[model samples]
Target chain A: MSAPTLPDLSGHFGRYGGRFVPEALVRALDELDAAYRTAKTDPEFQAQFKDLLLNYAGTPSLLYRAERLSARLGAEILLKREDLNHTGAHKVRNVLGQALLAKRMGKPRVIAETGAGQHGVASATAAALLDLECVVYMGETDTERQALNVARMRMLGATVVPVTNGSRTLKDALNEALRDWVASVDTTHYLLGTAAGPHPFPEIVRDFVGGIGIEARQQCLDQLGRLPDAVAACVGGGSNAIGIFHAFVPDESVQLYGFEAGGDGVATGRHAASITGGSSGVLHGARTYVLQDEDGQTVESHSISAGLDYPGVGPEHAWLHDTGRAEYEPVTDAEAMAAFQLLCRTEGIIPAIESAHALAGAARIVPALREELGRTPTIVVNLSGRGDKDVHTAGAYFGILDPVETLVPGENS
Target chain B: MSIAEIFAKARAEERALLIGCMPAGFPTVDDSIESMIAMHEAGCDVIEVELPYSDPVMDGPVIQKASDIALGRGVRTRDTLRIIEAVAGAGATVVLMTYWNPIEKYGVNAFARDLAAAGATGMITPDLIPDEAAEWIAASDEHRIDRTFLVSPSSTDERIAMTVAQCRGFVYATALMGVTGARTSVSSQAPDLVERVRHANPDMPVGVGLGVGNGAQAAEVAGFADGVIVGSALIRCVLDAPDRATGLSRLRALSAELAEGVRNPAK
Candidate 1:
């Protein structure tokens, strides 16, 4: 309808985003830009994607309300079941679209970067299903921390290259992936995982992911007859938030809160709250706020959660912050860990560390929200993924020991 | 001879010099640092310090990844100044190839003050237009941070003359329609773009940028301009390393290769 209430060609979300990638990827991204336009209008491609999401990947994931957890937090908490997606995260939504588009373009291989290994796994999963070659760049340290994911990716037929440059994290992995794309501009499609990166990508990612918010928005309206007081999601590169936020930007009544991971704590110099801590500047091909230092060299960032450990945020998130359409808040690792454990013990649902930041933020806001309204307000947390993968780390954090070591398995006391 | 004197000699002896762009932060901030240092040791005519930004719209992914790591390292404008200081401290004449935001953040007077303090000789803000550049030009002129600007083949005659008039150091001539990276073949008619700038200002040095990634590219570009700006290629040599030492070793060899290419253009 009115330009689809979507991003312009420059990748603007209202007044943000534009193509800022290298000139090499221009042809490919343009190919993508043109292809996606036709695909959006093409009944065949749309039908194919719909069927894949439905029969192959399982669409319309559940929205579960946690009564006990909500009672503990003194607020109504609803979980948007993105965890139940085919690959176990909302990132699949973006990769599926990008990979399918690559196949359409007759590209042979898909190259992507991973931080928490979720995006890599998701990309690998999609590539495997589509029978395309996949290459994933993961920071060396991330490979160690996410061994299971590393193995999973290898098993799924994706080559995991451990990036050993600079802090050896997701940002470096991105650097490695970009280098590969620059070298292989002729053949490969760099399947950017989030609503970040240069031009076209931010907008493209938003449109594909806007599926989440669109579905959630309509689903929420039908269920409650009105919009919730606030919509919250953890912001790493802000794919999910933008996905959900884009649909609700017109609805000013629905407050949007983005929770950035404050690893350890904000004051500890080991957090990933780029907006809260970073200044507005040029980075990753767009002018946006990033975590930078005095000399303008991007500072190395740290966060307990692998997904939210990125230094630079999505460009649209920067615009949302500047325009005051959405506000960003930082949640600490301890707080997130507490929420992870709380969700597990109280509701028997272990939330992803990335999603735990949102729950923790919700807990902090619940009291104030309750005090202001004098009644509980409906809060939708995009439980981005399940914490099944984070069990080892969570166990160590909660002082949970090896029970087998403590007691003999064969002898009865 | 000093790097400045060597560049000056190249201008006198070779008819022009080929100043390379190995931005202070690429591959890794440390590798970026090592690349610049190794280039200095290998004798880059003049080094361009690119103040890395998150949104490097004009850069290719090679430079983008390099800048990304520096940005990831929390490397900022101050870090670049220190790098300028490091090179200047080594008595190498340094030029900056950067965007405008860091200048805004650092403030005009202070930015000039710091650049002068760091011993920077010139600058080329790729994103700035001549008309809007007067403010920084004034400040840079005051501190002697020569306000060098960029000119593409598509630039009009009037724009060329105006850019030549406004330019302080050398005019940065872009070789291609795109960013700083290594490419297989630069446009065939690249000399026409160089000739356009050389037509207006024969006195000033014109260094060609964009898509010059190898020694051959550097040597090839020299035939077109006063000097060649070889950046992403030198950095690309060390892009694959497990540690700083390996990166430095690779960078040293690449810088030598680049310097050798600069010495002999035709072969």
Candidate 2:
């Protein structure tokens, strides 16, 4: 079969992605699509984007060989250190790209929807750097869970609005953002934070973050003289996973794996494993794998990692799963936390719980890879973010520190 | 009567039609059916039954609250069909309004077939546009049901024309560039957008929605448009009432006032 070419003009990834938004936003989507198309080929746009990635956001993040963890897991694991970026996550790359695009398009303001607040922080950072007005819509529950990130966003001169509707989580935040975008699309850009949502967004985000895969692909060729056996990344809306998987998609020898969040477990009916446990439907703006009831109402997704607690996965990941070019599995909260503690102890690396899902998934598949290869299997894992924001949650989970009571700052004081 | 026939009848009388909206199964399925019948008897020309969805992006807080109450009461997609059947049986011209996902989940063709069988004249899809509505368009045609796609103030001339061509019962004109809610004043953009839609297809009836509340606002919207669509304001009657009797009484009073407003168009 021919290599996969996706998101045809209509933004569909094999029936997985399309615009399911209101008519009020259509003109803005069209304008954005046109602007992105022009910017994609323009050398000036590329130069500006590249300059920021290299000098500001600090791209070409290190691809370190995790020998200690590899020894313990019986696999040669290479970690793509996206956590070391300026914003402590791979999300900064897409933020910077979109912020620059907003500037070029003459949109002075940007609005974003965030779940864990990492994307919100990254968006605020880029907005401050680009001198654009930024407003973030964060779920009320998330604002309490990730309070530090909220403060960080405020410090960057971004106004963070707490969304209180429907499940009070990521999906609600997304809905509120769309509502804002409808009224403000003329002067503001919806700087979507993932490789999901309508057409152009999935493609745009993948293109902006695809550098993770490009850099790692060359690093592997230089260090090991060949491609690794597998590439692993955590999939929420699947931005980081798609970021790392896009370049390796055509490399028939490299296996792509996306690890989704299994909150309690898939069997418990409370997990965020959209691709693994959900069915096909539309959410946010795209048709993808969604956790929904028989009546087509969206079901709330649960995950210890707030970033992965979304009911929908990116459309491309859904397409990839259907095409059998990639494999997805659920990493339960217990298993992810175990891998998280293990990484900190064995490798002295504190990974975001979202990224720990990748490490745990790699560990789960190592034995199978060993049996198949009859030798040490080389794997590249995308450490999508750092654990600085998750320290409190992790500490409480391990009983090292008492869980802090959530404070809304000005309320009930 | 069909939506087109109702529009024609209202036009012959030289007045716009008043369309009142409520979520199916708000509080409960049977209560919602009673609410629609009451609104119709009080003088709403058309009843727009919104299927309560979990994520209603286009709805403002008031409608969202009502929909949440409906979903919390276990209102399913099939329940919406039953509500539609009951409301239509009350001699009201009924239309179903929804986001695309529920219909997609119910199977587009199956939903179209069921909705037609249930006596809904057409569907008003706030989210689904003609650009991405091939499956729905085909299904709606095969089932002989009308499809109402919205045109917004932000819609370009080409897009408005394209969206108008795909519409059947009537073309919906979003008066403002915002979600569904009641505003203190009707949008300044509504008249211009209606004119644009008229330019696209003058013969196709245009129903203006979003931010319309109270008889005066309805009259102002009715002056220029063929239909004045009200959602959040009507749902608020039941939502804020102290009891069910109070809710129906308030609903009937408001519906009568709005009906009076539409009959006495400001134009």
Candidate 3:
């Protein structure tokens, strides 16, 4: 087979990604496509983007060898410290790139859809820096659950609209954002937060965040004197995973792994493992692996990490899985939480629950790699975010936080 | 009869056709069928049965609520086919308005066959554009069902021409760049979009949807387009009713008023 070149002019990854949005957004998409194509090769645009990533968002995040944690797993592990970015996550890279593009396109307003408000906060940060008007659509349930992040977004001078439709979650927020974009496409830019959604977005986001892999590849060579046997990252719409995986796609020798959130467990029928447990369909303007019922209606996904609770995976991840270029596995909440606690105790790193899935998957693959490689395996795991935002949930899970009287019924506690 | 024949009849009467839209199995399967039949009996020239899906991105709150009620009642895709058959049996031209996923999940060709078998004349897809409709185009052709793709006020002239060429029944022109909902006044952009569609293909029939609520709004839309498509306002009659009898009575009254509005175009 020929080398995997993706998203032909139509924005398809094999058969996974394409525009499935309303006709009203087509012109805007086309204009975006044109601008992105031009900006991709423009030296001035590249210079500005690189400057923002390096000076503002702080790119080239450290690639630290986790010797203490590596000893426990019996494998050499390197952690890509995306957690150290200015916004406390890899999402800052994407928002900055899109916000810059919005400025270039002369769109003064930027709108975004967020789940746990990580992306919303990042977008607001970039908007504040760029002097753009920012509005974020968040699920009403998420606003209540992640009230701290909501307040942070507001403090950044962004308006947060609570969406109350459908399941009242991330998907609803995405739907509401699309609704807003339809009416405001001329003056506003939808700064989509992930490497998902219609054509151009999957490609654009991957390109913006592709620096993760580009940096990691060089770091691995410099530190280990060889490429790691495998690379792993958590997949929620697969932005960070794709970010770290893109540069490895052509390497062919390196293995790429994506760990999805298994809320209860995949067997329990309540996980966010779209590739492992769902079928091919369209949602949020992209055709990908979606957790849907037999009748094709989207089935709500469950994950302890609100960021990974989306029902659909990015189209590029679906394509990668289909081609066997990457491996995906579900890491149950219990297993992820175990990894979370282990990382804090052993390495003094409190990783985000979303990134804990990747850490857990790294542990799970140690024995398999040992058997396959006939020696100790070197693995690079993308620690995509910090645990600061997840302190409340983790505290509640460990029964360490005070059980407040205001806790709603059926809340995690 | 075909959607074209229905439009031809309305054209002969020197009036635009009024197409009434209702979600299948809203409230319940039986009541939804009864409601559609009542609309036809009152004055609607055609019935558009919407299949309720979990994620309706283009729908406004009213239709979304109705779809949720239908899905909550366990109305499945197969039930929608049955509803279409019943509504068509009542002697009104019937079509389906749906997002693309359910049909893709059902298998595109299989859905076209089943829709044709159920007496649906065509499908109006809000999300499926001509650029990504190769499979649907072929399936619709093989099953001989009309494919009505939408052209929006934001659609470029080239895009409008491309979208209208794939359409078989009639070209749907979204009046504004917004989701479906009833408004106090029809958008002024509707007339311009209709004019653009006519320029794209003079022979192709044009239907205008979005933001049209009462008879006056319908009459204003009928003045320029070939068909006046009303969804949210029609569904709202049943949605806000106090009881089943009241819902049906209100639906009949609105249907008649909208029907009368189409008969006497403002033009």
Candidate 4:
């Protein structure tokens, strides 16, 4: 079969993605589109991006088989270990590509928005390595929760601006970043952190990060002697999912699954299940499924994992769900936390709460597949990040530290 | 009167058209209508009623705060239309300004029909360009509603021509390349952008917004454009007021000052 292609000239992924920004950003988007088109073909640019991915960010992350969990669940489970990448997530790949592209385009500075601070740290790292002025806009709430990430970004020489608007989360940070981009488009590139936003951004992010799928596909063939039956990844803005799913799009034998943050549950109206529960709308310059109310005001999404606490997913995910190219399921906080602990106990791997959502989704479906097929179905879950950043939240959730800390006395004891 | 007619009349009188903006249901729905009507009576030739949105990316802090208040108060699209109906009933040339999502969600044709029924003469869609606005263009044309598109300083000549061709009212020349806020100095790029718009279509009226705050700034923009649009500064007048009455009076005073400045550019 021919290679999978999407997002026609107008940037529509089957009526999903489009340029929904103000007129001030049109020229900048056009320029970025042209520059990316040219840079993708330039051998020097390709070599530089590849060098950074391999040498600096450490690409070709491990694909480990969770033998204990697989044996217990009566299914074969494999993990694409993006958590091992430098900065502890898959965000660095895209950031490195965009930052290099910024330099190639003669842009001296870059800006980005981060939620869990994973993207912010990755962007800061790229900026430091590339010698470009970097700024990261984060929600005020996020800065307080992800304090370690804030310090890391500052240490990397990227200014972290806390946005206090709206819900004071990823969406608000995105709004501030877009405002900055509009003002500084001539000299700065808005390094969008996800496979979202207007036109070239979603496509560009997917292409740069598609290396995950490219490597995983080859690894699956060499290591497993065949492709996996299903691939699963958590969907916030769906960058990692798209990155890993892009290479498998033309493989008709593979089934793709995207696990959205269910928070409490979709029925309780407190989840970020844009595909599972949302309607079609526009947010952050892209037409996609959004968590909005009756008046079309974007609703606040609640999730224990800051990385997945967004009201919208990338537009291509919406199109994929509509076209039946992929299936999306909501993974509740309880289910994800359970899977997080299970992965820790069984496999000696502490997955990010966001990645745990994908694990939870795989757990939900694997038992059924085992029952139906009466055989082990190989499942690949994209472990998008490490749980190091989420240790505090996990400890609080499991009450692991509270009882112990309370048992110990204060300084007097 | 049509938006074009307002600009033509202002041109014939050798003065720039003074356009005042206020978000609908700000402070409160009734109070916002009263404040806008007061500004129109004082001197505003055209009143742009902003439909408050949850995520107003193009707006500055002042306008964002105002919109937050309005949305927090349970203001809906229907309430914004009521403000337009009341303001237009008071003999003000009313235009609805909003981001594109609300209109898309509200149904473009339905929004156009309701806007026309409320006596609004035009729309200023900040986020909607001509290329992606075929639905809105058809709707507006069907309702005979004027469509005003924004042109920024960074806009290329080709972009300027395309935007102006789709504009039915005056082309909204963004004074600077930033979100809306009152500034101390009008952007140096404003006149050049206005000239570029004129070169594309001389008959198309050009209105500059995104920075004009006080009378002096209005006069500076008035020297080169057909309309001076002020938003964040006017909202700030109400926001800083001690009471609703004080806000209305301050808005009137600011409107009168800006109106005078537009008429007497040499001052």
Candidate 2 per-residue C-alpha lDDT over A71-183 given as tens digits, one digit per residue, 9 for 90 to 100: 99999999999999999999999999999999999999999999989999999999999999999999998899888889999999999999999888889999999999998
Task: Give candidate 2 regions above 4 Å deviation.
Answer: A1-4, A402-413
What is the C-alpha lDDT profile of model 3 across A209-314, one tens digit per residue? 9999999999998987889999999998999999999999988889999999989999898999999989899888889999999999999999999989999999
Give each prediction's DockQ, rounded to 2 decimals. Answer: 0.17, 0.83, 0.82, 0.83
Q: Which residue pairs show backbone clashes in model 3? A: none
lDDT of 1 by residue, B1-267 (tens): 333355467866674465767767565555566677677788577777888765454677677777766676667677788888877777677888777657756777899988888888877777665644567888987887777777765566777788888886677776765556777887664688778877897777677777765667667776666777777876676676677778777767766666776676653
In candidate 4, stretches whose alpha carbon ends up further than 4 angstroms from where it belongs are A1-3, A371-374, A403-413
Residue B207's lDDT within candidate 1 is 74
Prediction 3 TM-score vs. true: 0.98
Worst 10 residues of 2 chain B by lDDT: B124-133
lDDT of 3 at A212: 96
The i-RMS of candidate 4 is 0.7
- Candidate 1 ranges beyond 4 A from true positions: A1-9, A13-16, A19-28, A406-413, B1-16, B20-45, B49-93, B99-221, B224-226, B230-267
Docking class of 1: incorrect
The candidates' interface RMSDs, in order, read 6.3, 0.7, 0.7, 0.7
